[model samples]
Target: MNAQYKSCIEAVYRCIEACNVCYHACLKEEHMSNMSKCIELDRECAEICTLALHSMQRSSTFAIQILSLCAEICDACGTECKSHNHQHCQDCAQACFRCAEECRKLIS
Candidate 1:
């Protein structure tokens, strides 16, 4: 993988960690009912990021395509995360935004 792709892979890993943390954090929030959507999206984003990371690691020919989907999910997850007051959600949003931007470089 090129440096850009490598960097995106790292971002994907970080995003996975962030999403996992954010999901669990959301579950523990006082207003758990308000965070269900965020939790769902967080899990989806994490799964997509994991797939992208694996695809990149294997140097799959479709890695770029996978990253494209990952980027979209990351952006969506970030937007959802930003709706919360929790620090973990904000942090996860930032991570997702970074990962989304990095993933864009591969296809752009």
Candidate 2:
């Protein structure tokens, strides 16, 4: 794969990993109620990121479309995660933002 594609894929992978980790960590938090939004967004972001990764891997005609949605979800997830104080949430926010930026590059 080309450098650009490789880099974007790596970003997506990192976002997916971060989202998953954050989701589980949030679930285990003492006050899970407060992390409801973060948990929901993490699940959605991870699912969309997986789709984006697969679409890019196959060079699908809808890859850009899928990535557009992925970017949107990543932005939302990042925003939600950024509001939290947990280390996992902060890490997830960074990854989600990075993934959104990478996805935007291809779409633009």
Candidate 3:
């Protein structure tokens, strides 16, 4: 893979880690019901981010497609997390937004 693509993959991995941490934290909150959607999105985002990262790392022909899906998932996750008032949700939203931007760049 190219250096630029490797950098994007790293960013996605970082976002995946952040999202996973936030997902667990959100699940432990007292008002878990309020964060249900955020938690779900976090899990989905993390999985897609991992897939995209790996695909890019290997320079798969379908890397662009994976990046597109990652972007979409990140957008959804960011929106869902932003709907909550919790700190974890807010952090997750920021991470998701960043990941989405990175993935978007890879797509283009």
Candidate 4:
């Protein structure tokens, strides 16, 4: 609930929304085969972000490690999304990057 957590929580929530949007967008793409991995990672990243947010909210002792995992998942999702040329993918990648950075800050 501190200001230090505000940025990370906001970034995580934003990433969750972005990942959901990107996952749906990938599903609708005609190049479904190419987007399969991206969609999977998007779901995973969103789930991790949610877990990290809840852990932080509860001020859990394991929050730092959870955030670290969140950061790794965000990085992976961002990389996967960025491989595609779609605007949604690009936006999602950016959101993931922001979330990763914020999460790392909390850990450090």
Candidate 1 on 1-108: residue-level lDDT in tens?
Answer: 545577888899999999999999998999999998899999999999999999998888998899999999999999999988799999999999999999999889
Best by lDDT: 2
TM-scores for all candidates: the values are 0.96, 0.97, 0.92, 0.96
The local distance difference test score of each candidate is 0.93, 0.96, 0.86, 0.94
Worst 10 residues of 2 by lDDT: 1-10
Query: Comparing 3 and 4 by lDDT, which wins?
Result: 4
- Could you tell which candidate, 2 or 3, scores higher by lDDT? 2
Please report, as a residue range, the 10-residue window in candidate 4 with the lowest summed lDDT: 1-10
Scored against the true structure, residue 17 in model 3 reaches a CA lDDT of: 84
* TM-score result, candidate 1: 0.96
Please give the ranking of all candidate structures by lDDT, highest first, separated by commas: 2, 4, 1, 3
lDDT of 3 by residue, 1-108 (tens): 668796687778878987999899998999888877888889999998999888887888998999999999999999988888877778888888888898888778
- Two-way lDDT contest, 1 vs 4, winner: 4
For each candidate, C-alpha RMSD in Å? 1.0, 0.9, 1.2, 0.8
